[model samples]
Target chain A: MASFRSSLPVYATTLDVVWHYAFRTICGAILVFLVAPILVIIPLSFNAESFFSFTSGMVSLKPEAYSLKWYRDIFTNGMGAPEAAFGWSWLVDSWRHGQWMLALRNSVVVGVASTLVATALGTLASVGLSRPEMPFRGLIMGLLISPMIVPIIITATGLFFFFSSVGLAQTYLGLILAHALLGTPFVVITVTATLTSFDRSLMRAAANLGASPLRAFFSVQAPLILPGVISGALFAFVTSFDEVVVVLFLAEPDQRTIPRQMWSGLREQVSPTILAVATILVLISLAMLGSLEMLRRRVERLKTETPI
Target chain B: MTAVELGTEGLERRLARAERRGKLRAFLLVAPLLAFVLLSFAMPILTLVRQAAYNTLVSANLPETTALIADWKVDAPVPEPLCEALVREMHAAKEVDPAIPSRIATFVNRERAGSLSRVKQVANADIKAPYCAGLAALHDDWAQPDIWRALKIVAPSFSPRFFLQALDFRLQADGSIRSQDSNEALHLMLFRRTLLVAAGVTLACALLGFPVAYLLAHVSLRVSNMLLIIVLLPFWTSLLVRTTAWIALLQQNGVVNDTLVALHIIGEKGRLEMMYNMFATLVVMTHVLLPFMILPLFSVMKGINPNFTRAALSLGATPSTAFWKVYFPQTIPGLGAGCLLVFILAVGYYITPALVGGQSGQLISNIIAFHMQKTLNWPLAAAIGTILLAGVLLLYWLYSRLVGIDKMKLG
Candidate 1:
């Protein structure tokens, strides 16, 4: 009987070991599944062939034989290249010569302008909402933030009609306004969280020292809130840049953002140029993400060192 | 004794003055935002919702006729005499504006078509008055099944037909809520598809994010914060760029397949179905949404003391058991909050799936978009949108109930 009881535990222990190994293996495998597609797409962006699949030479282990011809084709326009092998020579030439650059520039311009505008408006709104002295405070904040909760499709539709009525439809100004409106909520949320940690007493101290309210704000308050504002601005910029639905309703073809351009290209044409564009985008995002990380760390450092 | 020191009149007067100044300043500070929201957001939505129920074209053009049939019930085909009245009113409608026929045609076509097409044409032709006489003289077939179909579709009075259609239900000829079959269907497959896709994406985010967040919280703060930003960086760039970047990396000839082939992980003959598939959709969506999950989990995890695990361990529990029983349960609120927010966001997402999902991968929002932009079915689109809004709100309510949202800590 003692042996039977002891043997049962040994069996259970073996089962437990198997279970642990299986669970870890499965979870890690899933993590790979999660991370692989993202990592895999990097090399596919380098394929020399026009087809989405690999050719014999492209997949070979030897790095020496692999050509940067696809990258080159993506960067420069050569008129004399034979059309015999691949169907996308014109696309290759166009992409190489810098037409995509214009689209990229337009996207950046729109993203930047909208972000700046949203951050400014959102900051003012957040400040007003934060003040205890402001009346109907709850109601006003709710109203201001309602835009975020509403369906973007509905917002897009409303913007379409509203802009069309004012003749701002299809204009860059219209797209900017639409993006700004949508992007403002993120700024408000981020800045409000930052403002919560703010010491109202610090402002009073500056005032007691005979600093005017404006000076107190600029000298003392602004520096403390600057990190929040910057984070909010970056969020807004990214929000505007990545937005597609509202842009689809509001932007003309000429005003196509990179997303809008990618959307059209995906729907109308399937090409490696898109892949090239995606790779560049990934690189830019990684760099931006890295910088944002640095900013966040700096903020954390400030929080710990300054006690307030 | 001290209370008696101040003069009552002086204190009251001072209070009144302060109140007046406070009120004025509040107005000054608060007015623009109220005006902005009222004018820019609230007014537009009110107008859109109003249009969704009853559009201006129907009210202004057929006010008299609508008033005549205002009490018409759904027991039978719109009264035959009402149809005649509509035919006459439509004639007058054309005189007011040539666009009435097309407008009315939209409503009528939803029901019977062939019979109603002639009625629309007659209405467009401006054949007014002694309308039965006009109808007889015209000898047009306005009593056929198609005409009734068209007329019924365009019929007035704050009908719930559009709303029903939006939910993928249609008001049958019998006026019952019935499942739409192939022949007479208004499929909300896309909306449901959007919801399903959104759920799947949210699940993926949580599944991947929970472990990473657990690692960050339990591990050293330095490493945790580093991974946190790595998680947040995509959030800083425009989502458009990140999504596009995924496309490049995932495309057939894209980096992933190239690497795999080079490493001989998979044979070179077959290409990975990297882009424009469910795998691509989930991959890009999860990448976009991972930060949302991580941030909330991190904040909640930060608040949880390490002692709970140690206490459990001291009680002779295994480390994994201690962690799961004591630590994981406390993080549920964050998990719920993160999942709700990400799922809600994903449900409404259009761009990522549209670009990466290909034809088979398209979700419901894409259809709603098509209806809004391409088909110009404003009422129908509004109906669909209203349903989507309701679905999101309902899900949020369920989440709040399940998770006790007030307790969820956020970054």
Candidate 2:
């Protein structure tokens, strides 16, 4: 692979070689540091025992030292009867009664709804922003993005007071609204990036063909920017899915999302089931990252292929 | 329709009309979100500001005394009328709700300690009008201007007392502001530590991230793309998961300690108490936020014309000089954005510190949450929030200056 050494001068001094290799070592260590913790949890989640550390048996590669009980516990921890024969009723019992399952449902409901709201609103706003005729572009953008930069604690405090007053506190609708507001900035940034780099001539061509503005957008623009919209929606979904502070402030016990559940469980006890949940969440994020990378490459390819 | 109007003026008028329509169309697209954010996000923050600024407990319950003492000098002898009104109000509040006086006392106790009993005593007593002498005889706190001044300070619906307390200062009996004693300076201390940790984290991230970002930028496209995943994976991972991972790594009997013990670097009984301290907070936070530093620097470094540095080197500059003078300055804007962004996020971070930050590791955000949740002191939390909000917004302004708001990206 081509690295710094590839670009180094032939007449490089001993000092240059030492610095180049030293830089490489530091960068390598940083990458390992960044990834090791997340990777370590994957194997730890499969540990036979409840202890957080690697056991001697597991370290010695004993096959019997690993187990799937924690993963199973994610579904059966709060189930009414785990001893019930493994039948349809047992599946139904776990699905309906499991604490983690309920949290997962809440997370998905809130994540999907908020992502939809944020993506819809943000896509429109980005469209408006991309227009040369838009007014107060900078100010509007600054305002939209302010929700992100403002401390979540402040936002949570404000919302707690305001929502309780207007009767929005502790409700799914209130949470959705809050998460939507938090997610919009991501949608706006991604969609706007896509829109600005968008080819205006195609829209002009469609308009010249007697298509209305909306028709032009649907026919000539949406396909090219669909990847951007998907990426933005993914970000919004992940944000709401992973969010904890607002959930901590706004959610009732029934409305606890995954992060909120993990928070309580963590505070109460260091259960391996939380590790199981973390590992699952990590997998979901990996999937999200994979898709986003693909979309990024597609966008890059389009930008290059389209000659100005 | 245009048959009769075919001149330059008509064409210009038509163009102006088209422009207006375009502008309106654009605004209409943005109107829904603008309204949504204004109502949901902006309004709640405004409510928080009101919470921080207004205290209704004193003004509502102690209305008569608050009004009577409105003009009373703090250092003046406790007026008999003021004392009488105060006692009457206290006794009346005792009649309506026995807890009101003590509640007021507890509320005031935050301002001046040893107040819980004083206000409770007056409320419980049968002191009558010309109650000043009797009140003073009952308790010296009644005669002193300090309690009266405390009441005066809390009397108004609008007050700076919460803000003062948040900043570790207090309004005195005579209305002069004094910084609190060291033992009372928790909020001020948290604010300082928050800033210190933020700066320290920013520096640490720059040191750790600069080289990796340089590698990503300098490497071939394929290799760089492969390495970029390492940064993006952490960025995409759930924050709590990352924090939990750190706990597992740094706990006393956890991986790092176990590895150290096995390697004989530390004895079995000497396992490090790395978790629940400033060390855990710093390491975990730096791990979580490093991607933010790397992505921006990599993006900036990738755009630099390599020839600029080569040109410097060709001009007989030493390798270090060429790198520093030519290469380093170019990365400043990126470095600035990354540092400021990390600092802003770090100052407001609650989860990592809350989970890993044992006593000494708590930041302003943690204390704010503590007040909000455990202490049930919403007004004080809101006050700390106001200060944090101001500092963050200032950084945001600088951030927006360094990189346009529209340019904020995700990997």
Candidate 3:
């Protein structure tokens, strides 16, 4: 198409080619602007020096200009003596003292726990919501999903006071509940979407075959909807993992997640270690994005392949 | 009645019962989550709103004093009975909870600044008969009608003082609401700034996003999907990481400045202070929210039949004219949804601004957080939060009306 447009003498006027190139140029620049910040951090995270910008040697692509020190720092950052010779004791010390490691643990724990809660409740409610017999489905769904729409700051402040009065503030339970509340919307949206395309007669058929509703769900429905469920769970987990506002209000210093840790790190001190963490997070998001894309394709395929 | 009619009636009753049972089962399935959301999300916001108009620290601690001053005229001097009630209440409160006077002082200070010490001083002063005169002797502020008026306003356990303060209004000594002094008016300005920044970011995102979305929509499926991934990658990345990337890029010693310096756009000594200002906030936010704009726009543009524009062009119209007359109008729904979504998200934005929003860039959310955590002033925080929440909910209501919330998609 490009060659055809450029090859035609009369069709390819100077004005037309200039305008076409200009439009493409602007689009290209905007796309680059969208992804540049994320891409820039990857190479900067590999800088041997602790600076945020590329060093002269690095600009010249010197082999010695890059190092894994920051990535290594992710593990050894808080060790009592990180310079100590490599040994099992150093590894133990790093594991015990590394702040990022602790934050990683907290992130995973909160993410998984909240994802489980959100997925279970959201999936169940979506099932009921998808039913033709369900009452006030729109209003109910709206209320359930308001957490996603409401400004998170308002939610955080509200939860702060509520949790304090109920003795849940500054506890893992408080953080987990807050995250699960935030995450539930994703689960509800995804599971409800999957349910929309579902065939009700399958369940009715299973019932006619003397299968209990639970048995029918596990055998006939769950398998078909598992992609949506897993993808929703992944989203819920990411929501929890990436969340920081609620953590700032509700989490204790001991309960800090990776984002919360990066927050203070960025504020109180700008460190290259943050770049390392950011790189890892970018990679994680890439993996998540890939999985989601795959799951979407799978759901589409399943929808097309099903006779119903 | 015939046996057939009787049997048909019985079957109808059984079917009705079965329908009711199914409805009950569906309700039960939804019940647990409904209860959880109500308990966790809905109830918390309600409590926050309640907190805005609820003030109890002063009244609860000095009940007798509040009652004594409730009917006192503003023009009159501090009555002996009020002073006596205050002293008695203070002593009693100290006996019950040593922290009560301080709490009362804090609450009073919120109304009339610098009066807390006077309250503390009077609370500790030894008074011999003639209570009003003795209190006046202990602290000259005790003789002032303004202190009395401030106390009276908050004397009620439930008062709208915080809400009034949130709007930069205050109760005068004569008990009339008026605008706060210019020097003290912060929240109203913060609210305006928040709205302005949100609008700016929304406009910027729209401008930057429209072209990219148009390109993506016009491209082949494989190319568009790959570009969509490029857009979604940042959308999926941790927000803090993106904000951090901006900081690295925009800081004085960061990549942008370094590049500019190398290119002689600005000398080393003249490096721009870019990181901690509104520019940085707007730039970072637009980047963060661009995907939101693009996705909706892309979806809408993809759905738009290209034939409309082509047909217009084929008939007598130029490409530009056809685009304006046909393509642009069709994308309004997407444009509206994206703009509102970005604006809503931008207004409530806390983390990005907090990280990079130095003094000038901070929004209302930061102030809400400041009061909630730093100042320990929950009521004021609640008031600010209520206002921000109201604005967001209004926009959301509009968005849902214009473009159903059901159509809102996330990668």
TM-score of each: 0.82, 0.94, 0.96
Count the clashes in each prediction.
Answer: 37, 0, 0
Looking at chain B only, the TM-scores across the models are 0.83, 0.91, 0.95
Which scores higher on lDDT, 2 or 3?
A: 2
lDDT of 1 by residue, B1-411 (tens): 366556776799899898878666546644654565576667666656665677556656777656655555444435556656777678788888887777776666655544445656667554555564556556546433345443444556567777877766767643577665566454466766777788888988898888767766765777666655556555554565566567656777666677787889988887698789877887788888877887888788889988888799789998679878898899997898899889877877777777788877777666677778787777777777666766766766665567543333223
Candidate 1 ranges beyond 4 A from true positions:
A1-36, A53-56, A61-99, A133-143, A149-151, B1-38, B69-92, B115-117, B123-130, B133-140, B145-149, B172-181, B184-192, B234-284, B358-360, B394-411
lDDT of 3 by residue, A161-233 (tens): 8998899999999999999999999998888888889999999999999999999999999999898899889
Q: Which candidate is the best by lDDT?
A: 2
* Candidate 3 chain B lDDT trough over 10 residues, lowest sum: B120-129
Q: Write the per-residue lDDT of candidate 2 for residues B1-411, one digit (tens) a residue.
A: 375667777889999999999999999999999999999999999999899999787778778888888888877787777888888888888888988888888777777778889989988988865789988889888778777777787778888878998999887766789998888789977899999999999999999999999999999999999999988999999999998898889999899999999899999999899999998889999999999999889999999999999998899998889999999999998898899899999999898899999998999999989999997878899999998999999899888887878667777
Report the Cα RMSD per candidate.
Answer: 6.4, 2.9, 1.9
Top-scoring candidate (TM-score): 3
Give candidate 2's error at residue B243 in angstroms: 0.6
Q: What is the lDDT of candidate 1?
A: 0.69
Chain B structural similarity as TM-score, candidate 3: 0.95
Clashing residue pairs in candidate 2 (N, C-alpha, C atoms within 3 angstroms): none
What candidate 2 gets wrong by more than 4 Å, as runs, is A1-10, B1-6, B87-103, B117-145
**Evaluation by DockQ, superior candidate among 1 and 3:** 3
Deviation from truth (RMSD, Å), model 1: 6.4
DockQ for every model comes to 0.27, 0.82, 0.78
